[model samples]
Target: MDRKKIVEIISNHYSPLTPECKLDLITNSKLLVLQKGTVLVRGGQFSDKTFFIVNGCARAYYLKDGKDISDWFAFENEFISSINSFFLNIPSPHFIELIEDSVLLEISRGNIEILSNTYHDFERLSKVVAIKTMLKQQERITSMQFHSAEEKYKNLLSIHPDINQRIPLTHIASYINITLETLSRIRKRLTRI
Candidate 1:
């Protein structure tokens, strides 16, 4: 991917960058092309790298009691990181994995700090992105707490209509706290309706 495209994606996702901020990001961020099933950050690893998906998808998930449960997903134009590890300088509790062959822009925590400290625009961009990620987590929690299986499935579909095509159903079921059978039934019922 070219520098201009990366800058455009950053501006579109967060806030517009200054000319200098754009240059700094272009210089600091690394372009990555990774295949499906690449684990960028594993559970218990300290990871300071954050990724912006230029193309394809990734998910942050945890392995609990031998079951894999997804917590978050990022697709084209979205960002994904081991948030706790990235911010708290601790080991990540979840794994970040690419779901498809992906093109990404990776930036280190040190670069983010430098850019945020030096550029007002970068700071604003970071704040905006963090707030957005937090709100998405909140929405997921609310949906899991109050929505019925069918309602949860519908709500997810509303946010990501093509998610079924892009992501595995098992991961989607886990993310919404449903069993695979329940998700299948819901999908069938909705299709008939």
Candidate 2:
């Protein structure tokens, strides 16, 4: 993987990085190509690494009563990390798994902290990303709290337009807090309209 290309992609998705900041980030991170079903972080594990998806997608999910419930998804140019573990130094409550074979840029929290302190551009970029993540989480919480099943599905679709093509129905159902059967019925009903 080309480090410069990776940095360019990151800059395009988030804030533009100063040349020095970009160079330091390139030096501190790693480019990886991982296969599908790879588990980056597991429940109860300490997760210090955050991955920027260069290609493909991933999800953060929890196992509840032996069922997998997806809480978040990240695709190309997006970042995925066990937020609690990464920020609070606590064990992760969910698993982060790749949904497809993926190319990723991996960065450690320690390096992120160092870079953020050393570079104003990196600090600003970090703030922008964090705010975006926080807002997305807030939106999801509001949707889950108030939206009907169909509304939730539509909202998710609006955010990730190609989600149905890329993600499994079961995972989508779990993310939307609906059963697979109900999601299928909703899809069918929507198609008929």
Candidate 3:
């Protein structure tokens, strides 16, 4: 991605970066082109890196008794990281997997800290990112805890209307905490209504 594209993405979510901050990011960040099924961080691994998805999507999932349960999905122009592991310096309970061929900007915590300390605006940028991440997590947890499987799927569609076009039904079923057969039934029922 060029500087202009980076600028546009940053500007879309947060405020436009200052010239120095932009230069620092352009110099420090690495563009990662990863194919589907690429696992960035596995369970029990410590991930100090955070990925900004410029294109495509990634899913955070947990492997429990050999069954993979989807935790969350990050789409284009969103950030994906092993949140607790990245901040707590501990092993991650979830694995971050690229679900599609992705273009990502990878930034290490070291670089983030450097930028946060050197530039005031970078701190603001970090705050904005943190807030957004927290809000997303909050919503996901709330849905998983309180919503029915059908309601969860409906909420997912409301949030990302085109998600079904990009993601597989199995992953969606896992994310919404339903069996694939149940999800199929739910979809059919919704279509009828």
Candidate 4:
């Protein structure tokens, strides 16, 4: 991935980083090409690396009662990490998987800390990322508990307009806290209207 391209993506989320800071970030992070079905972090494992998706998509999910319950998905120019484990230094309750072949910039916790301490811009970016993550979690919890399956599905599309085309129905259903049959019915009903 182009360093400038990645820098531009991050700039969209937080304040623009100085050219020197972007160069430093490029030097500290490693570019990785991951295949679909790749599990970067698994439940009960400790991994503090956060992946910034330069391209493709990934998900964080839990294997609950032998079923994969997707919690969230990240597409191009998004950051996806095992949040609790990465932030709290505990075993992850979820697994991070590449749903599509992905190009990622892997930033380790130590490097992130070093960068944050060294550059004020990185610190600001970290704060913005944390805030966004918290807000997303809050929204998901409230939506799943209060919203109907159709509402939840529609809300998801509002947030990720192209998700239905990119993600599988099973994953979408699970993410919206509905059965696959229900999701199919909702989609069919919406299409007819």
TM-score of each: 0.98, 0.97, 0.95, 0.95
Off by over 4 Å in 2: none
Best of the candidates, TM-score: 1
The digit string of per-residue lDDT tens for model 4 on 55-168 reads: 899999999899999998988877899999998999999999998998998999999999899999988888988888788889999999999999999999999999988899
* Global lDDT scores for all candidate models: 0.93, 0.94, 0.90, 0.90
lDDT of 2 by residue, 1-193 (tens): 6878999888878899999999999999999999999999999999999999999999999999999999999998899999999999999999999999999999999999999999998999999989889998999999999999999999988989999999999999999899999999999999999
Q: Please provide, for model 3 over 1-193, each residue's C-alpha lDDT reduced to its tens digit, 9 standing for 90 to 100.
A: 7745774687668756788888898788888899998999999999999999888999999999999899889998889999999999999999999989998889999999999999888888888988999999899899999999999999999999999988899999998889999999999999999
Question: Top model by lDDT, which number?
Answer: 2
What's model 2's lDDT at 180? 94
Off by over 4 Å in 4: none
Candidate 4's displacement at residue 187, Å, is 0.9
The predicted structure with the larger lDDT, 2 or 4, is 2
72: Cα error in model 1, Å: 0.6
Return whichever of 1 and 4 wins on TM-score: 1
Show where candidate 1 strays beyond 4 Å: none
Superpose all Cα atoms of candidate 2 onto the true structure and report the RMSD in Å to 1 decimal.
0.9
The Cα error of candidate 3 at residue 190, in Å, is: 1.1
